[model samples]
Target chain A: MNPTPDGFSTRHRGGKKSAARKVRRSSAVNRPSTVKRGKVVSVADGNAAIISKSFQLRSMQRAWNRFHAGSLSHWTTTIIIALSLTIFGAFTLLLSNANTALDNWTGDNLVTVFLEERTSIEQIESIQTEISKKSGVDQISVVSPAQAMARMKNMLGSEAGLLDSLDDNPLPFSIEFRLTDKKYKKTANLVYEIGTWQGVEAVSYDQIWAEKLAAVIHTFRFVGIALTVLLLTAVALIISNTIKLTIIARRDEVEVMRFMGATDSFIKTPFVYEGVLQGLFGAIGALLLTSLLYWGGQGAAAELGAAFGIFFELHYLQVGQLLIIMALGIFLGLIGALISLSRFLEI
Target chain B: MSSESLPLLIAKGLKKAFSVGKNSSLEVLKGIDLSIDKGEMVALLGDSGSGKSTLIQILGTLDRPSSGVVTLNGINLFALNPKEQAVVRNQKIGFIYQFHRLLPEFSARENVMMPLLIGRCSPKLAKERAGEILEKVGLAGRLDHRPGQLSGGEQQRVAIARSIVTEPVLLLADEPTGNLDSRTAGSVFELLQKLNQDLGLSCLMVTHNNELAQNLDRQLHMIDGCLAEEERGK
Candidate 1:
């Protein structure tokens, strides 16, 4: 029998326990056991449930300390996302501005003249020469009825060839004219005056088509604005979801932070900062990609345009628009982080 | 023994059960009664499935008991909401697990300062306290080393420093030495003993090794969710 303080049975597998074992068992007497107090019957019944301000400060510090180590992966994801957005942005710009340029191309004043059926070839040539001499006429080209018919047959295929076999030569001789419209809408008046000529049969113009095209362009501009809004929303959602997944992976860390006395705000602060950082990097990456594509496209268009002594160029996003893009990227990133935390920071 | 006037932790009739498999329930702790005084240390001994960890978790307020009352510094933990419970745990208690559980990405000093910062201390104060604790735990030279860079013993030391930096009322350890070699284990235990004595901090440690259990101030052997025997320090 052995007598120790608060003794029970001294017998065991051996005569004596080791000094380390004695030291290990001695700690049991150091504190009052919750078991003896009869208060902690389960996990829920403890008194240590308050968080102090110091805990929150600690959490913020830990988050900042870990910031650099975790930043690389976050930055990489943001850059990839930004690159994709830039490509889509460039595509949208090309689609919208290309149509704008084409509208301007068609709006330049041009007219077509129809000659009487019996009008001789000399009359058409003289009419072209007379039109070219006019101050309003920039250039004119006379087409003989037979040559016009042959060109139509070549362009329109078998149906047009069949028209050439008709009993009467129904095709009209014509001259096409480019105009310098002082009042912009004066091309219509010029057409009316040309129609009243003795040898002229009729005048034709595409003013109605131009008006309709203008309406279509107006609708396209509205659609482009809507698409941009939708794309930005999508970008924000994607970034937010990604950040949410990251939060899930670090759940244990978050739990530890909470136990360390960190407030919810303290924990979330670094995450928001991280999201903005990622967004900024992503925006820069996207801008770089957009510029590369723009320069390459301009070079290719210029090369193609050189063949016909015509010049082609791409219009880029203006400085103001570029600023908006960066702002939008950062805003979307922040929104994404907010969305992620909404689901994760419940506790 | 815990003084009735300044009891550090009090647990009453704690019961925790879990539903596992289909229509089957297993109770981990059944009507456990415990108390810890300020500056006391107790070793909770148990077999493989004796619910020691569950008990420690509940006492630490990391988890809620299915049915029971726990009061730490006279505050009823079970009555509080999850948010409040988190606040309490953050401020009043510190926990160490079998594994060091140190964040691999952080340096030793940062790891130690986690609880202090989370408890909302000033960065300078947290840093200073973290430095003090690290030095106390024999980690003075490894403050800037990450967990991966430090040896296992050093990492555990860092964990010890982290647990004590907040000056928590209760420090819970779940097999703190389970992963270490015998020599390193002794040194770790020695550090814990020094902290308990020098700081007068309360501790509740769960361990399986009968050898480890016998060295604490008091030992309670838990079997089948009930405390079977208790022995006090000489």
Candidate 2:
């Protein structure tokens, strides 16, 4: 006999005649019994194959059915998750805009040393050279009294006639230099050292307000992160409780499936899918809410910036940040489902 | 070795105990030794709490014995891991509960298709087999009826169809007709008998109906966690 691909052994030609003769003699009584055993064994082997795609589809169907059956509760949990994420997203938007405004304010890092009224050009040049030689100085420029007066007139915009009525230029000659290191302490120390110079009348920089704003931003960031953590934890807990309720409602069905020999994965997969679906929908809702908030707040924020004479524009979350939020929602849902299943689902 | 000589299922010295208190335990099955041959329909009769259900559970691999061995087709059932045992239950054993236990949300056809689906059979084949078996149990016209819509007898017929749809080697029925009227119970028992004769499906049924028990191949009576008497039925 030769082994065939379908796992049956084929008899050679010599036995074929006798096999056919025997089959013809008692075909009704004998043929089907042997064929029936073979078919059953084949079916059993088929059963032992990997889990079918149909099973997964059925689980998804069941999950969707349960989700529909508890629409009110599921939607309520989803809204809670959306609201939590919206709050977090709002804080993120605020911090992002604040940080951008602060960056623009401190970007120049310029220090101005005002000269005495009678300082000579030679003295101004000497001060400029000395400032340029400092450790953190990048670019130095000498601003004559006339140039300073011109800058003031330009700033006054449509009021330059009032500047001309001063009868004489009272602006002081100054030397400005850009600092490579913008640290408040470094800039302050440099200003103090320059104030003691021979011909320098005063020294000033915008480091104080920048440093204060930076501190405020840091504090706000910390608080926002802490708040987001708390809110997400609460959301996860709510999801866990919601899933627990559904499990309780279906407790009898679960027990029946277990007795019918459903695998643990088979029983639990639908619940896991339910959690994931909740998270996915919740995240989508949060994104939509956050977008609405951004559009609603954009014009108001711009007007507020104009009041303070600062150019402020609200930027929506970056692609990476949006992805992070979505991922967090999904992860929280998974964790919540796992928590409930581990605690309540004994099978 | 012929199929008739080798029993399809055998339980030797099976014992089960439950811890009742800190220092006390309740024994359910002191020790049970039983076997059911191929194509044999055996009836188990006992009063309430006589360990009949526990024995059925153990033999079906739904529960484990505290000690002793249960071999189905010469394979030690308890020796397999839970996952493998579940596979055995899915493919080799079928259960018919007293309450018909059909998922109320699904129709009769879907309920009957469940075991085959659990065994990873294709949905189309499961549906065809389920429909065929439902018709075989005289429920052809009620395939779409949910359990809530079906009468008690019709529900039991659906349950029978589900149990036999898998074509399992052994059917462990715990009071399959317990909740039906005598007329309904007799009809259900006749269906079981017909399936046994036509399909050669082996069964171990727990029942309180002695009249029905007397028609099976054998009847074992349980009394206080022990098999007290055995009678060959005609």
Candidate 3:
């Protein structure tokens, strides 16, 4: 039955189709792998002819083959996802810490009490003593009008005469009270208490600064949450689509695996592993960048502090937060890969 | 032997169709009724687009029949769910195509062990079985080579090793040697003949080669999606 053809061709048999063909049998060997059933122990010759009706054997083998074959892209994707998530974690931790420091350090809670013009030194001293005992007051500093002017002159040397030439001491005698916590409600309560004191002409706290602080805190929390969610959704999508593209590129390989009797789970394992690997790698990239930024910021802060007595600290990525970020990145990659694979496995 | 007495694979009035172009349905196969008995090598010969591939797909349970029933051994194919159908396909049937569909990323031995692994056989046993089969196919030394590294004929042999490693009841081939050179193609056919003789494996092949088709135990020619002639051959 072997044909000795030199090249590819289709020879037409003189009509629409050939008719009355004869059948011949040849004892040929070396058949295609698809047809060759290897020699094995059998109870009867007919038992070999009767194809055993079991599908699990081949599918299991295909799964193992895929894993060992390095056909799995899931591992790679997982690493990338893990890395991206770590960045998010670092950002969230640093942001929260920064907010806490700002709320604690702001001057919004400082209260100043102006003394009455007719008030004597003895009366002012008693008022200062009473204000210091207030529950919210952290500390109180008393500045007399004359002392205030002297201090202003000592600092402005050249402008000292201009300040002294004033017809009267323009600076008022005042007692400044600081609050423990910068909560606006607490600050207002303290202000109300101080304003009711005798010999006090006026009581005011930095209301504008208080309002600004409130706005900053609110906006920060809101923007942080929104950005994190948006970035995560984007990351998830990118990983999912990337895995899907990989699947499409390797569809033929998948088909081959299926024909080998691979189950859906078997076919999906390698892809999931690859996704996780990708996520982890991405997370590591983000961490490296975050680490560099932290180091650079700390260096800059040190230079600034040396040049001028101003201190600044950029929040760094905490270990716990870093771990969570890594985990999240890996999770995102796996989920994304699974989503893409779900659609293809149905076939 | 009477048709009912010979046990292998039987499809009664099997029909398959596919929808194309959104609304139009093209019936690829008009009802086909045939039986492949034990130890018989049946050849399905037809030109391209004559539903030859479609018939093999349905019979192998890779695709569903639009109508009628297919029974492999004693189990009804259409009655089983997809998971169970997959189980049936894995356990009972083997397949060979013109193109060696051995996974390129996996070694030849690993490819052969796939079916056994899927069936939950122990790794040790699967490995031993795979080793034995690969040796039989004369690929003992090339077991570690992936499909990409092997010649076309050798790759096809690996594919063959994978298909029958689990000892299925029926093997389906769709022009198994159509992609090989004449010499290699002949050798591949010879291996199929050997497996049939040595193991009594029942085989049904779809081919355009009349010479290869005629060598089977029985020849069924398809014209316009129906069996035109059935001849008993040497």
Candidates, DockQ? 0.15, 0.35, 0.15
Q: How much does each candidate deviate from the true structure in C-alpha RMSD?
A: 13.8, 7.8, 11.8
Best-performing candidate as measured by DockQ: 2
lDDT of 2 by residue, B131-219 (tens): 88899999999998899999999999999988877667899999999999999999999999999999788999999999999999999
Worst 10 residues of 3 chain A by lDDT: A22-31
Best-matching candidate per TM-score: 2
lDDT string for model 3 (A13-104, tens) is 12222111100010011010121131212233343232222222333333334334443354444444544554565557556655554554
Mark the 10 consecutive residues where model 1 chain A has the least summed lDDT: A3-12
- Stretches of candidate 2 exceeding 4 Å from the true structure: A1-58, A115-123, A143-173, A198-202, B1-4, B19-26, B228-231
DockQ computed for model 1 against the true two-chain complex using alpha carbons: 0.15
- Give each model's whole-structure lDDT: 0.71, 0.80, 0.69
Clashes of each: 81, 0, 89
Docking class of 3: incorrect
- The C-alpha stretches of model 3 lying farther than 4 A from their native spots are A1-90, A106-108, A116-119, A122-141, A145-171, A180-182, A186-211, A300-315, A318-320, B1-6
Candidate 2 residues A1-347, lDDT tens each?
32211111121222223322332232222111112321221223343232344446666676767777766788998899888888888888888888888888788788889999999888888888888888989878888889998898887899888876687889899988889887888899889999999999998777677788899999999999999999999999999998999899889888678767677878898898788778877888888999999999999999978976678888898898788779878887888888889988887
As for model 2, its CA RMSD to the true structure in angstroms is: 7.8
